[model samples]
Target chain A: MKIRPLDDRVLVQPLEEIESKTSSGIIIPDTAKEKPRIGVVIAVGTDEDLREKVKEGDKILFAKYGGEEVEIDGKEYRIISRSDILAVIED
Target chain B: MKIRPLDDRVLVQPLEEIESKTSSGIIIPDTAKEKPRIGVVIAVGTDEDLREKVKEGDKILFAKYGGEEVEIDGKEYRIISRSDILAVIED
Candidate 1:
């Protein structure tokens, strides 16, 4: 079954970041660290202005504890309100 | 100096509740109790739609961890975002 977010909400698929080395040769570990709130937009809400600003497949930056997790068709996704979105990650 | 909230925020003076006995003879103790998120709107934000919904001196219900506290002229108040407001209480 498919889920459609209502009002000024969006469905997002969170990007899980693993341990990685930075340019400074420092290892950033994901274990015990706050999960990054970055995600890709799966479905945009029906709000006209919000739809104009955010499109499907666009990457987004959301608040640290913003979205609600929902399991759909064995896939995990988050439903985030418009106010919780911090910015649209450009490029 | 008088404070004016910008955007879709509101300035509110929290209404603190004290220990009181209910009609059911249940003495509702205030000690160790979570502070109620109810307050009177001191000032409304500049957003037109928000202004239309909330007004100064209006009693409102806000999210538990929604607003930021600030002291103005020795009086404590909270700055709450529009999305954090749950409902406007009517008397």
Candidate 2:
């Protein structure tokens, strides 16, 4: 299932969170764990200017609590506007 | 204390989360809560082009799971790249 962002929004699939315990070997129970804040860009918006600014596969760093929450195909994703973007990762 | 961002990085102070229980009044324990994702722009980067792209006071929506986490004066913030920004709020 392909997701498309409207206007200047971008669809992102978050990177998986660490399922194991932390470096200290303290197993984090489900309640104490923080949701993962890393993700991959799935699709960009229709804005020509935004399209010129970013691409589909660019890796980026963004706010952990930004964007609107969305679930697709039993998976979770976010729809964030282009202005919320922080940086484009080169790699 | 004032913070400045380098290059295209943006310094954002996240908005406080609901300290009280959720609407359901379930009294969500801290262990089961998620980190706050909403933030206010503390500072914009030094890139002139990027500076023009964004401003210091603009409210933005971004990826919930993005940016590098940093601590300042015992407070936590994130330094996200510009590309992670999703939208600029007009209001």
Say which candidate scores most in TM-score.
2
Predicted model with the maximum DockQ: 2
lDDT of each: 0.66, 0.62
Give model 1's docking category: incorrect
**How far out, in Å, is residue A55 in model 2?**
1.2
lDDT by residue for model 2 over B12-72, one digit each (tens)?
Answer: 7655555222322323345634432556687887678988878887666555556666454
Per-chain TM-score of candidate 1, chain B = 0.77
Per-model TM-score versus the true fold: 0.43, 0.45
Per-residue lDDT of B1-91 in model 1, one digit per residue for the tens? 6778999999998765421111112121233133225578999988887787778987664555677999888887999898766445444
Backbone clashes in model 1, listed as residue pairs: none
Model 2 whole-model lDDT (C-alpha atoms): 0.62
